[model samples]
Structure formats: C-alpha cells, structure tokens
Target: MVKSVSNITPFTLLDYPDKSACILWYAGCNMRCLYCYNPEIVFGKGKFTFSEMISFLETRRGLLDAVVFSGGECLIHKDIIEQIRLVKAMGFLVKVDTNGSKPDVLQSLIEQKLLDYVALDFKSTRESFLSITQTDLYDQFEQSVQLLFKTNIPFEIRTTYHSELLAKEEVKDMIDYLKFNEYTGTYYIQHFKNNVETIGKLPNSHTRLENHLPVNTAVKIVLR
Candidate 1:
C-alpha cells in the first residue's frame, strides 16, 4: 500500500530528544483541530511514496541517529507499523508523533519494539474535545493516552494552547485528566504559533492563551 508521507526534513536536533533525526511528515488526519498549523498535510495528498521514503532512509543509516514520523497523525496511516519495523531493522531508532487517536497501532509498535519515543498530542478535555478536534474521537484519544501511561515507551504529551478554543480552566482540566489517570510524564504547554493556515477562524493577535495556564502538579510542565 502507498503510505501518506507528505514531506521529509533531512535532519533536526530538536524533534527527537537528544538524537539527530529526520522527520517524516505524513499526509491527512482523522481530526481537524481548529488550532492546527499543518492544514496542508492534514487536508492534502502526499507527494512521496513509502518506497521513496525507505530509499531515503537507506542512505542515512550511519549518519543519523533516529527517524521521526510526524504528521497529519502518522498513526492514521495503516502501513506505519510495518514501516517502523523496517526502519528499526535498518538500525535507526524511530520516534512517532501522534494525536493518540489510534491505541491499537501505538500498542502494536510498543509490543513489537518498533519505536523509541512517542509525542502524543493531548488536545483538550472531554468537554471541549468535539469543539477542538471536530471529530467524535474523544474516547479513542483517551484510550491511546491510557495505553501510553501503562506502557514502558518514553512519551511526551502536549497541548496546543489557543484562547479561542480553550481557556485557562479548561487547560487545567486537560492537565488534570492526565494526572488523574496516573500519568506522570512530561506535559508540554505549546503556545499556538500563527505561522500557518488553521482549520477555523484565527484567534486575535493578542490572544496569548499560554500565559493563562493554571499551575499543574505531579507532572513536569514545559512551556513553549
């Protein structure tokens, strides 16, 4: 099957923790978060094929440390599990960036030892989930989060802070959901950068919602 990989960043030191890696940006996503900056990949088709990506990876074997599969929700692609396995076999650590909507794929990767790190987006609380994602994926998203909490795989849970879709109290609710569920991992409060096209109306320029986040406990918070 043809994979929906849209673009690739040959190298970056920031994407994966402490590793020199390349980014595989996939195409299309199941949810349409209003604050998302990657609308092109989320709504458009990919330009490259799975075989092409493999050919590219083949050339980076010794020079790179890891490969990051970010998307348009990388796990939405069915062929990702096999691709991860292939990359792992090629002697490179694999990191996947997902919105935590597919626990089955995430679990499969963990069980098969196909990934080294995971960056799951904790978009919103159940109350504001539908408004943010524009999908009935709240249950599925929660399942992925809980599954990650139980796994040994290293992960970073993040949220896009937008004043238009979420408030200070609601942001705390999202953080609380993680803490209540025994999640003690790092939770990043990502401030929405108005650099690209978003799904819905844009927030006002002064809407710095990240500054309003409530103090959270038990988990490490990295403000960006």
Candidate 2:
C-alpha cells in the first residue's frame, strides 16, 4: 500500500491511454534520481491522507474511465494493493507508473489483475543504472523487468533523453538491452524538459534524439 498520496490532478488526458483519468501522486521514493521533476512528493515535502483521496475519486465516478497511480515509487508502499483494489472496485481501469523497483508488488498487482496499463521507466544502460537512480538497484530492476515480460498485459517502456546519462551510442545499447530481453511493447523516447527550479540543469541541447538519429530510424529502434 502507498504510505500516502500528496496530490491529485483530476481529469488528466496524457496519463492513461485513450481514457479520461485522474492522477494520484504517491509520496516517497526509494531512489534519488537528480532529474526527478516531482521532488515535492519524492522528498516528502507535502502529504495527503488516503481518506481525502478516496472522497475525491468517489465524486468523479462516471466522469473518469481510469486512475493513474504515479510516484515517488507507488509500489514501495505495502498498502498499494489495497488502494488499487479500492480503485478497481470503483470501476476505474487502473494504470501504474513505476520505476521497476518492486517486482514483488508489481507481480502481486498483476496476479490480482489490478492494472490495465503500466509505464516503466528504463533509465540507462546497466553500466550506468546505479549512477542514474543513485541506488544499487540492478537486481530489483532485473526482477521487475522479468515480471513485466512474463505477463501478457499491455505496457510501455519509456526513456527520458538525458544527455548526462544517454547518448546516440548508449541508446543503441538500450535498444540491445530490450531486444535481448524480447520486450515487445511500445517504447517512448520522451523529450526531456529541464525544470530548473526543481531539477536544476538542462541536458546538452546538442544531443536531441532528432540530431543524433533520424526520426524514422529512431522510432524503428525505439519500437523494437
């Protein structure tokens, strides 16, 4: 379960696939990625009680088609299953955004059929994964990846184009990582926007994906 949620952005179109949804920002993260934009939740700057969150969701029952539980690592909280169950009982398709840290929790949710979609962040090549997440997370990430691959549920792998951690060549390594594992879901190469107030630095502008790889070529590899 989640320790608590700190914020709710109602009626988000971009979070859940093809459905109107509410976004729940869970508090606390195990990793300390310097590039994290939601530091308020990550650092526990503010918190919201579960009762208040449930009340809000209850108010919008028919208006929304889904609920997206984003984090600060949502799966870290032991109460995650309970929360997902509650949301599912309310008849909302649930989507989870995770960093692939808690495979056990993820697996349990999958077994209980709690999620409709999962968006997992694949941060960097294995060699630099620790540096990127600022944690010794290889084993946990490996387990999470395995669990996702084992499941037939629809999912996506996302990468933020961080010049400090990834490059043209490194993206190729990332491609190889996915191909080797036979990950057959959608892969999104998201443009990294620098929020200087929160994250404090911009990635090198010269290293945009379009500059390094042609559009068609990048998509072909990314969608692999």
Task: Compute each candidate's TM-score over C-alphas.
Answer: 0.93, 0.89
Per-residue CA lDDT of model 2 for 1-224, tens digit only, reads 22388788988888777999999888888988767777778987336777778889999999999999987888887788998999999999999999998988999999999989999988877788777778888788878878998888888888877676666788877777777777777778876665444443545434567656544433334421
Instruction: State which candidate has the highest TM-score.
Output: 1
**Model 1, runs deviating above 4 Å:** 1-3, 205-211, 214-216
TM-score of 2: 0.89
User: What would the TM-score be for candidate 1 when compared with the true structure?
Assistant: 0.93
Report every candidate's CA lDDT. 0.85, 0.80
Give me the displacement of residue 141 in model 2, in angstroms.
1.2
Clashes of 2: 4
What overall lDDT, based on C-alpha atoms, would model 1 receive against the true structure? 0.85
Number of clashes recorded per candidate: 0, 4
